[model samples]
Target: MTEPLWKPSTQRIAGARLSAFAQAMQARHSELEGSDYFALHNWSLAHPEAFWQGVWDFTGVQASSPPKAVLEHADQLPGASWFPGARLNFAENLLRYRDQRKALICLLENGRRRTYSYAELYREVAQLAAALRRMGVGPGDRVAGFMPNIAETVIAMLATTSLGALWSSCSPDFGISGVLDRFGQITAKVLFAADGYFYNGKTCDSLERVAGIVKAIDSLEHVIVVPVVNERPAIEGFAGKHYAEVLEATVTDIDFAQLPFDHPLYIMYSSGTTGVPKCIVHSAGGTLLQHLKEHQLMLDLGRQDVFFYFSTCGWMMWNWLVSGLASGATLLLYDGSPFAGQGRVLLDAIDEENITIFGTSAKFISALEKSGQRPRESHDLSSLKTILSTGSPLAHESFEYVYRDIKQDVCLSSISGGTDIISCFVAGSVTLPVYAGEIQAPGLGMAVDIWDEEGRSLRGDKGELVCTQPFPSCPLGFWNDPENKRFHEAYFARFDNVWAHGDYAEITDHGGFIIHGRSDAVLNPGGVRIGTAEIYRQVEQIEAVLDSVVIGQQWQDDLRVILFVVLREGLKLDEALQQRIRKTIRENTTARHVPEKIIQVTDIPRTISGKIVELAVRKIVHGESVKNTDALANPEALDLFRNLPELRS
Candidate 1:
């Protein structure tokens, strides 16, 4: 086994909130006398009810009615119920703090910065909640936002949830069809949108798309337009009021409606690469409890910390980032391209704002590395301590670059979870050692395990990543899935009662996890299952390669690996470069990992969230139709893969 890349010092571990929580647990429960993270995790999984109840008390979750039962039908995975008799408001807990301290700090690509104090945030939410109420938005009504990641977006969501109405949002970058696919299914009563948004130093107007969406979705009775780019966009055709006008109404206080534990709080959607996105409805209490556990205990976030995540309103990370408010930490919101000013925009924000915990995707780190931007050498990242990465698996080379080039002392947490839960199954730990290319440990109270084809548990081997127990963050159900048939087929189909998260992963010797890739995108060549990330890890190491995507092509009654490379500008894939690519893959991995064919493409298709669409590319390469090209950021990139002359050979 290799040595850990980084380990928390005695002082760091002792100062961590996780250590304090463990000590508190030891004092409360006799079985949790051990102080290590592994011991605490085991105790948590063994007694989930007591563990969750302890989290609730430790976090001081405000509730009108406490849970009569912590968990019911614990053995049933999808059927299990959590917090049986609890009545709590998700937005109220987040808005619990109303001091002079800063609650939200909004930043834009055009060097515009705004700060909202906790008290001011409360006032805005109150005003917006009043406006929404006047607009006839009641409990259980769907309220959607098609806006940028600004303070107003957060305020609107808080206001909607405060009234017990469900909230959903997508970034302005999404096209009309993508927005309609998500909001159209739920049929929201109110639509909040921005006049325009800024990206890559350019302004993109959204009124045209907003107009089309309102026309298509007949359930929208009111459209509230926020003046982001254009202060007063023409709303002559739309039946709505300006965002400022709505907040200026006569309203001073907010009345938070107490709802059941299982009441819908937010509706997250699947990637919908293959089909229409599934509207996964998450519960208020579950999202709150899970995010609190992750924020307070796992990430060790506190009132003094400043949290920043580079996310759009569409992604689930935005939802996760807002929960920092409940932790009493100041939340940072950035809207625009991270590469707007040659990648220095985000790096500058880290130093300017004294950001403590910075959250981003793996691709961003890789891009920073490829761009030859050394933040540690040029920027003052003294206040930065923890770096959280998700969206995809973090490469081992990227991990090395973090400790070597970014910061040696920081905790580089590679977290993995999806919109299905709105929280991580395996995330970082302040008390544990950080191994290269591995998540520190399974989240506390998450019974994560690796299962084989026959539903048998396995360790130290690559298999399906399965959660053997129910967690608090599980979605209530699908939006239109009346019988829960879609929900069951989505998660519980592979295993009898286990939640089969569609990821190929392995449990490491250090009690960590290494996620290979998506299980559905796993390549089976010559009857051997190979993870696409294995090839990507090697290919990305080449200096000439900017990006690459691999897929399995069916040929001669067997599958063959086909690799597509997006080379750097002014570089071409020649015979020598092909040999170098194959040599790198064969030397680092086995010969089976080498691609049978290497083709160079201009761009790779990805979703709005920056995840490469492997399955969609595979379908197009095999002369099959891609169901929804509208979900992709570069839908035209699919045309490059279709009818390729090289594939015929």
Candidate 2:
């Protein structure tokens, strides 16, 4: 048997929050007294009411009214209700700590830094909440933010949710149309934006786009601007108010609205790469409870830990990062490009700020490896403990690179979930050992399994990732999805009453889950199913191939796999490199997984949150229109793949 990459020592296991949680639960409910994680996980699924109630109590969730019952209609996926009769305020729970501990540390790409203590953060939110209250923003009102991932953005969101309002935000880099397509659907009453933001040593102005968004959305009543690029941005054309001016009322306290457990706290949007984005509404209690469980139990977060996830306001990880405040952990926020400072900017922050838990996308980690930036040899990383990665499958080589070059003792956890749940279905557990390329465990109480097309559970094989039972953090529903027709069709259409998460996945012998790729983007060639990640894992091992994207194209009578390569600077994809690519894939994977044609391109199109858009690229390859180019970070890259002369033969 192969050995794990790393394992927790006896002291580490004994000190883990999971161990402490298990001990406390066992004292109250004797059925959960085992030290085995899978045993505890099974008990959680079987007695979900007791498990969730234990989590709520263990985390000391600050609720206005205790839950009358833990769950209602527990068998229904869409109809199940959690903590139905409880009343709580999301912001109030997050802001429960008022001491002088550092709550937020803001780092910008342009060498700007700001820090906010817990007391200061609470005061800021109180003032902002008071100002929002005067504007008549109340329960069920929608508030929008077109800002960067700065302290102000978090403050604004807390203030909005404090008044029982729903908050939605997009990064400042989003185009005007993308902003309108999202905010237009919800008819937001207030908008907050930054004047401009810095990216890769370039200043990108956002006020012009904000003005355009204001004119397009007639429901907007107010626009507030924060100065980043300029001290006093010219807001002449638009009647926008400065962020500081709006908070001059000097209010020092907040009246947090104690709303229903299922009241809307946030309105997240889908990638919108295929069509208009779906506004996914998430409940306050569900989001808070699920985040507390993931943060405290899964990540082993504590008050002394400095937690950081490199995410923008547009991505769901930003929401996940902010929830660390509830656990009393300091949050580190970074804006602008992850590639700034020769890709050492984030690495430098780890040493400078003494970050304990660092989170980022799998693409960032791969890019660091490709750039030959070895932090183990370059920086002091004694304070760092865990690294969280998502947004795509973490290639197998990237896993090796981290233990080899990044840090030997750190836990590298590649988690997977989406905006659909606003949390992870399969995530990391501190109690588990680190494997080569696997998510450590299924989220407790998730009832996660891999099933074939017939809905029968499979072992050691690739299949659809499904959750037979519902979990908290399941979205309330899609906005304007009356009768839930579209919502049901989106998640439950494939299986009767089961949540069909659209991911091509496999269960490993270690009892961990490996996400191959998006199920919808699985390549079918010659009647054989091949996941793109399986090919990517092998191709990325070759140093010359900087990045690649694969798609199955229609041929004479069947589908053929086509590959596109993005070579390093001044390097060309000659015949030798093509043979090496095919040799690597054919030897590691099956011959059918090899691409029929290998073409070179300058760039690959990805979403604004940095996920490669395979479906959109496939549509472009087949001479079809990509409905929403605004959702892409580089829309121009799609043109490089169109009408390729090589594909004609």
Candidate 3:
């Protein structure tokens, strides 16, 4: 059995919001008396309606009308309707706080910082919402943003949703085609973009990309340009108003439109590594309630906490992080490379701002460890209490690094979910123990389970991660998927009414989950199923290795594992290092997990969100056409794997 990396003390557990909520629930329900974490989780799944209602009441959700019924058609997967009689605006809940306390702290890479009080933020949102209403934006209309991670982006989203418009956005770093692929599908009426932005100490102009995108997306009526880098860039060709001019003439009061519970609040996109991106539409009530539950109960976020997640506007974490405002926590937004300032930028921000809950990716942690930067030695992170990691599976070694090198007393949680639901199915709980390389527990009211090939639920074996019951955060459906054929094929095609979440996972004996990798990219060698993350966990332990990707290649009428590595600068893939790589993988994993072909590459192709695209590379190596090259951040890297002499053998 693996020892826990960190465990909450009796005082900490008693102080957690989860413990308080559980105690309240126990007082209301006799069956919940003396329920532990696992028992409470099981009860929540069994009585989802009661549990979700409790979440609403405990969070004090601000809705215009209370729900007549908790859930309708509870047995149906995609058709389950939650809070049928409720009416609410997503922006209303987020803007509930109007005090003078700090709400948002904006930081740029070039030593620029700004702060917004809750009252100031609400006034700004009201001004923008009024401006949007004057432009004829209304309910069900789509509005898009091609901007950086800044205060204005959040303001724009809030204003749009306040007018009952569906909001969608992509980071300014996306190319013209990538932007078109997403916003083009939904036909946004208004498009907001920055003139330019700074990244990695360079000012990257967005004017040219914006020009190309505006021309491609036909439904765009108004193009609002924000002067991020330049005070006023050349907007000669485009026909629209400047963001400043629009806001300057806006009124102070906003008329927030009250919509149905299932009104479309956001349109999130798939990674689109394989093909065109799917616009997954999420509901207003569902998004608000789920975020409230995760924020207040699961994460134990509150007013005094300073919350920060390293993400671009395009990533879903940005959406997740912005919801912190609803919990009355101060949001810290940063727009630049995390590696800026030689990786000390974010660490310095933590000390300066007294960040309480720090959220970032697993890759960032590994990079920090490899950089030999021990934050605890130089920074005062005493204010930090919880560290959240996602984007990819956090390795066990990274867990050790967080406790040993970062902060030992803090809770390190490796959460896993996707843009598909816009929230996590399994996340960390403050009342639970933190184990190495394992998510603390399945989220309350989420029926997360691991299943075998025959659809039998398994406890301690690796299998598909499935959600048997319907949850509020499941997307309303995909855009342009009128018959829901695409949505059905995407999630429920694998099993009957069960959401096969495409994750190779195992429910540990401790009631935690270990997500191996995406099931589509799972490696099968000699009829033995293997996860790519299993190999990556071992291969990344070598000091000489910088990054790696593993895949199963068809060879000799049987599948064989192949490994590709991006070695550290000035290090070559010689026999000694190759032997070390193979030995490390063999000793940690099984012999079959060792790669038959150990190749070195200068780069690994990843998606724009920093996720390694193993499926796209697999298609490239097999001489198949990758359907969407625009989906990749570095598409040219695919050529490195093409026509390789080593693959011929």
Candidate 4:
């Protein structure tokens, strides 16, 4: 393994931001001590009550009563609810600080850009909320959207949540079946969608699919089309209103409906690896406190900083990214392919927006490196103070590439946490130094520890990443999982009470962490265990490859590496290319890195949210049945892996 490029620096927090947190507390009439980073982090883990109570104050989290006490039931893992008696509103906290500060910046793929200030956003959200109320939408009713990352999407989410309604969303790229598979389960009375979405120099229309979905879902009685990508579609058989029709004449005074703390704030669905996607319900107060801790303490996003996380409307990262609004920073939205015009479009956006905090997936960084695209060479990225990476375990070489090609003196935060919690277990810390191949620390109040296969906790060793103590962010429970069977089966079944996040990780002796890969995706070749990322790190760094997926195919009661490479457009996986891949792997990793056969494909299968589905592909190669394949972007890609002659027993 290569040494880390950047470690923690001496940069300290400023008073103005800290003062904002303090003011938020005072306005809510809550009591919290003035504690520093490390001190408060340890304190929170030790005293869970005091920790969450502090967040309730720190973020000015409004509640009707004092919880009836915070956390009545802490012993029950899945049933444990925070601030059960308190009444709060998720959107209220987000819209608390209303001023002339730039709230959101939308950069469309069609070269159209629009900026909305906090005042403007609040007005739109209020007008839309009133329209929904008039449409018979109330608390507990679900509102769904097929949208891109833009001001209209945020406004819709905020408006829906403002009415104490459950909000769920997916990107426009999701097909009719894909949308139906997810939205089918949730009872969304109102469907919000765009007339079209622009991506890769093309304007794709969603109206027909929106109409199709309206016919499919019995609960959907209304549709609202936002004119973002193209002109609004003509109203036909569907009884709905365009966004302009609802909010053109805006009302300014937005009254937030306060609901119980445990009220469902969002209805985010699972990727449905096992079966149909289950709706994961997040609470109002819980989601607010958790996101605040992540943004302020972990990421340290401030008003001076323009925060941007490259994400679609579908992913949980989009929800996480949108919370930057509560932090008073300009939330930069890029609603299209990162490589739409150029591979460096996002990097160029950072320069244009003067974004202090920039975020993207690890796959994007690797792709940039593979394409030999240098952003630093072409653009001035000095305003980029920090770079955030997630969605997959960042390869160490990708780590080196960030410092060498992206920025040197910036914090490269590789965060790990997922849909299960809606917050990070192991994430970045403002006070800590940046390490090239590792995440700096476990998030504050998150009692994260590494555990071995035996369920025994281990330090300075790689094992299943587990969180021992109960966290505020753990999903209340899966929606429609009446007996909590799926919820328990998903998380608690692994190590009883501990949260087995399904990632293989090691806490460094120096207090950093190195995530190997998804624990379930670990490859055991000839009894020697190796992370899939280990192979990808070496294989992707080569000049000849575009992207590759390494899976362990079961053969003769042993595991063999079977690699599928999608070469750079016209490039083919020739003998010389295969040899170069092998040489690169052997140099960077072990003999296990080299695959037995390198298969070529036109495209790779990914989830609607853009994550490579290796296990599904493995099942396909083994001739196993794939259920709910609608979740895959390229479901036909799985067919290429089946019945290969080289894999004959």
Candidate 5:
């Protein structure tokens, strides 16, 4: 029998918003009375309309007009219309709270802190929106942000969305070509950027890159630069205004535009490692409702809670984090490397800010554990109720590390979703027990399942993760993909009328989920499919291995697994270390899962959002052209894998 790492107390469960939602549903629908969480999930799928409508009501979505119908053409995956007649503003819902309570707390790498109350936040957005309106940015216009995760970035997004304009953003670290590939596709009319940003005790300037981007993208008419590392940055090369000067107008009100539920609100980009990034557009109503459900019901977040997620403007989690404001929760926005203070920056903020919900990537948690910084013994984390992990699957040892080293009582929710949906398919439930290496449940009304190649459902077996029904957060469609050709092919073509999420996953017996890796990145060695994450879990447990990336190399008449590792300083890849690595993987998984070749490298290449790019490395090893080098955080690392003598064997 497998034991759970932690379980919510009776008092905690009773106090959860999910429990209250269950009670409310039972009261409305007699058939749902006395149903457990699993039973309620099934019922939600059976009656998605009622479930979503109930969520809209429970979460108090501020809409100008109620939805006439919850769903239309429910059978079509790509074509389904949700809340067709509803009229709402995504910014209006997020900025509904107008009290004096703290709405945003901005923390920087150089030990700077800035805060804004709800009333102050509204005023800032109001002034910014007026400025954008003066610049002719209104309905259907696109505004892009090349800034860090700070209050101004959030304010810019809110101001843009308030006027029914679509907003897009990327972290300032993106190179010129990368920014051009994404923001160029959308033809953004206005750009918001920071003069520079601070990271790892260094002040990196963005003016040169922003000027380059503005010069390349012919559609940009206006540029707003926020002063970060400098009080005033020279914008002589570009036609731009200071962000502070733009907000100097005495505007005190926001004229929220009421648009259709399916109106485009955000333009997100797919990591353009293989090609030019796809510009995915998400609807306002869908994003609002989906985020609200995940926040209020799944996280049990309320006005009294302090929520924080360590993310850059480029990542989807930043979008998700900003939605916490709709729940009236205060948000902590941090801008810097997560390892600024020897990996204590984030954990220290939890104590200083009294953050109740903390979110970060799996890699950070693993690195923190390896650093031997045990927060349970060093920090006061009594206010933390939840710790969320995403970007990749959470390792089993990392799960145990959370309970053993971080906090015993907190819920460690390892969520899985991507920029495609802007929300989660499998997430944590506050009312459920915390199981090691397993996501608590498929998100409510997500209709998530694992299916084999033939589109047959599987249990306790790795397969493609699929959603058979339409959810609110599904992308409106890819920008410029007229007639929905590329959009349909991206998701629906894998399975008829199903959203193939591209993740290789399994449904555990505990009614939870275990995501192995991405289906595209799955290694096929000797005709057997192997998830890369399966190898990563075991290799990461080794003390000498700092990081690793594994891929299948096309060898003589067969495919063999190749692993590249970054070792601890002053360490070398010797026979003993290689054998020990193979032994660990072989003992935990299968002999076939062990790497055929282990090569030591200085670093592993990753995306700007901190996800390892296995496909890019594979392409480099195979002597294929990587279409966009700008998409990688460390494009130079690809040179390390090129023409390796060991792989030639």
Candidate 6:
């Protein structure tokens, strides 16, 4: 029973909704098991050409010229070109339906709300496209947005694509340096941003950061300011215009620029821990077809659903969540702190908006669980059908917490993928049964496998997570990296042609999967494999600590787990606190999982994007150089780690 494959329970998802034309091909192969999802998955992988071609045809994706085949280059994973010679615009596929159906639910930090219908959204995007065109925006040019997750941000992205301009963005919360490290690289010609944004009870202004970014990036030609809270700032040396004024003299029929299938639809960057940020360019056609498969078939997202992902414009979740509109679902966009004023802000939004698909990070979920938050018991969350968790590995305890404390019947999907692909390697499928702590399967088209240190395949055992071939979402290449050296070094260098995602995971007997932690983040105590998330699952359950990070310190030729905790407000980390942390972990996990030393710290270093920097902290504690402190939000925090009395032997 404990094999590397499991069958979905009764009432599985129907086979891909193939067109009559494609069905004839299936008919030619009568031996194929079309009804079984796994059978279909294996068949697609064996014939990658026919699988993607079917996806393009079924989605009705508009293209200027259909390609002769699905892939032009297959043997070379890094050089694969999907739908070669095809020309399509990403915004056109997203804006297909122009009826009065509600396209978006615009939310504010406070009590204000605004909704846009499909027709209204189209009109606004057209005006913005016209506005950008007047500002000298054209094909292959960069347009950046420093804005919140609201109507204008989505409009700006759509509008940029409409004009065949590349769209890139950062959330308003990004500090000047963080935003500059990313946006400064692409050399944006036009910038669209909000003056200020509200979160919790306080208003946060972006004017200063915007000014600094504009000053640093010499290519910025114009700034279009959307006043969300405060009056717009008057910055010198830049041509400025109001968003409303830009839309004033524009018509609603701006044409969608026809570009090749591989035209850059969006530009996203990697966290620059090692060096300069790598700008990942995605395609218009690939993004459209892939999102369609994820939304319509996997997620079953429909117009009846009102979706919301608690994310900022900077995160890829924002990119994924906004694509819900392409499924004709009303996406609920909230601009504020997710956990504000008692951690009930998102719950209130869910109740008020009746959000059907509510997504958040695993960190947020674990925090809520630790806080003893029971929104299902207190608030009305009946509208939510699925709860999605990602960013980090969602622990087994977190999975159990959702079913036991949050909602018993809701589908708890713990998905994992990253900025590199701009999509998921493993995600949810409503047609499949929910299991505790496991992602149901490798996303249908993904050829995901588990490999050990020797590069040999290992199933039903913890190993490295890898993908075998060129998936559509793979970044074309790193920007300014002419020889494609950086892109190859980042993913393919580990194992030639195979994408080493650096995640410690196992493929379960039932074809389900479990993520332990980042292979890089694993703690080796006495040379035993220990997932950092395992300690986190147990440590956060202690009442005194708000958060903690476990790192392995190399001492006397073996690794030891040293825990640093941030105590809850007004709490002291004394002997009693250490006892509680150790006891909790030992009782819940194993003896090796418990920390050897428990220390208190003011804060843990994280990227501006909210990823914990375990490697950074480990470097500091071991008296090694933290190669790039510039990537950290609080670089000065490392000073406390150095010369610690406890570190000296």
Best by lDDT: 5
Q: Given candidate 1, what's the lDDT at residue 240?
A: 67
List per-prediction Cα lDDT, in the order shown.
0.92, 0.92, 0.90, 0.81, 0.94, 0.80
lDDT per residue for candidate 2 within 1-649, as digits (tens), equals: 5588888777777999989988888888877758667877888998999999989999999998988999999989988999988999999999999999999999999999999999999999999999888888999999999999999999999999999999999988888888888999999999999999999899999888988999999999989998888988889667799998889367888899999889999999999999999999999999999999999999999999999999999999999999999999999999989999988999999999999999998889999999888999999999999999999999878888999999999888889989999999999987889999888889988999999999999998999999998788999999999889989999999999899999999988888999999999999887788889998898788898788888989999999999998999999999999999999999998899999999999999999899989888899899999977888899999999999999888
Clashing pairs in 5: none
Candidate 3 local lDDT, residue 461: 84
Cα lDDT of model 1 by residue, 1-649, tens digit: 8999999999988998888888888889998868888998999999998899899988889999988899999988887889888899999999999999999999989888899999999999999999889889988999999989999999999999999999999999888889999999998999999999999889999988998999999999999999888778888556767999888456768899998888899999888889999999999999999999999999999999999998888899999999999989999999999898877988898898999999999999999889887888999899999999999899999999999889999999999998999999999998888888899999999999999999888986899999999899999899999999999999998888889999999999999999999999999988888888888899989999999999999988999999999998999999999999999999999999999999999999998889999999999999989876768889999999999888887
lDDT of 4 by residue, 1-649 (tens): 4455765454454443333543454454344445445555666777778768867666566665667777766876766778777877788778877889999988987778899989888888888888888888889999999888888899999999999999999988888888998888887899998888888888888788888888899998888988865566776657768888887365776678888887888888778754788888888777788998888767877778899999888889999988888778899998988887767678878888899999899989988887787778888988987888888888777888888987787878899898778878888865566666778778888888888889888886678888887777788788888898988888889888777888888888657788888888888888777778778777767766777788889888899999898887778888888899888888877887688888887778888667888888888888898888877767888888888887784
Report the lDDT of model 5 for residue 328: 98
What tens digits encode model 5's per-residue C-alpha lDDT throughout 535-601? 9999989999989999999999888999899999999999999999999999999989989999999
TM for every model, in the order presented, reads 0.99, 0.99, 0.99, 0.93, 0.99, 0.93
Summed over model 6, clashes come to: 3
Superposed Cα deviation of residue 46, candidate 2 (Å): 0.9
lDDT of 3 by residue, 1-649 (tens): 8789888899988888888888889888887756567778888987888889999999888888888999999999989999998988899889999999999999999878999999999999998888888899999999999999999999999999999999999988888888888999999999999988888899899988888998888899999998888777779667867887888344666677888889999999999878899999999989989999999888999999999999988889999999999999999999998989888999999989999999999999999999899999989899999999999999999999999999999989889999999999899987788998899999988999999999999977899999999999999999999999999999999999899999999998789999999999999888899989899999879999999888877888998888999998999999999999999999998998989999999999988788999998898888888866777778888988898899888
Off by over 4 Å in 2: none
Q: Which stretches of candidate 1 lie over 4 Å from their true place?
A: none
